[model samples]
Target: MTLLDRLNQDMKQAMKNKDKETLSVIRMVKASIQNESIKLGKDTLSEDEDLTILSREVKQRKDSLQEFKNAGREDLVEKTENELDILAQYLPKQLSDEELTSIIQETIKEVNATSMKDMGKVMGSVMPKVKGQADGTKIKQIVEQKLR
Candidate 1:
C-alpha cells in the first residue's frame, strides 16, 4: 500500500484500538500532508513529497526536544520525545555508519570533490540520495571529514 493508504489503515486501527495518542499523531500527519498538497496545488502528493514532510516534522521535533532539554523543562522534553517517537515511525530506517560512509565516498567521487572548497557540490549531489535515510548533520560531518 502507498504510505498514505497505510496511514489511513493505521488511523482506523488506532481508532478501533482506542489509541488516543497514536490517533492524534496520525491526525497531525494527515493535516500536514493535506496542507502541503494544498500549497503545491496538487490533488495528492508523491511518495517523495510525503517523505519530505515526514522528515521536516521529525527534524522540528528533534529541535524542540533539544531546546526543551537545554531549558531544563522535563515536562516539555517528555512530550516532545513522545512526538518525536511518533514522527520517527514514518521515516525510513536510518543508514548505518558504514553504509553512510560508503555513500559519502561515492558522492565525493561523483561530485569530483577533492577538497573542503567543494563541500557544497558534494552536499548538493549527496543529500538527495541520503534524504530521509541519513541524518543531515551526520552526513555533513562525514562529508567534511572526507573533504578535509
Candidate 2:
C-alpha cells in the first residue's frame, strides 16, 4: 500500500482506539498532505513529496522542542516529544552517523566540493540521496565539518 493508504488506515485505527494525541497528529499530517496536493492541483501527492512534507513537519517539532527546553519548559518539551514520536513513525529509518559521513564524503567528491564555496553543490547532490533517511540539519553539520 502507498504511504497515504497506510496513513488512512492508521487514522482509522487511532479513531477506534480513541487516542486523542495520535489522532490529532494523524489528522494534521493528512491535512498537510491535502494542502500540498491542492497546491499542485492534484488528487494525491507523490510518495517523495509526502516524505518531504513529513520530514519538514518533524523538523518543525524538533525546533519547537529545542526552544521549549532552552526556556526550561519541561511540560511543553514532554508534549513535543510525544508528537515527535508520532511523527517519526512515518519517516524512513534514519542513517547512522558513520553512514552519513561516508555518504557526505562521496557527495563532496561527486560535486568536487573542495571548499565552502561549493557547499550548495554538495548539499544539492547529497539531499536527494539522504532525503527521508537523514536529518537535513545534521547532514549540513556533517558536510561543514568535512569541508572545514
Best by TM-score: 2
lDDT of 2: 0.92
**Taking the tens digit of each residue's C-alpha lDDT, what string does model 2 give over 1-148?**
8778988999999999999999899899889899999999999788899998898899999999999999999999999999999999999999999999999999898878989888999999999999989988999999999998
Count of backbone collisions within predicted model 1: 0
| Span of 10 residues, lowest total lDDT, candidate 1 | 81-90
Tens digits of per-residue lDDT for model 1 on 18-76?
A: 98888988898899999999999999899999999888888888888899999999999
TM-score of 2: 0.96
lDDT of 1 at 128: 93
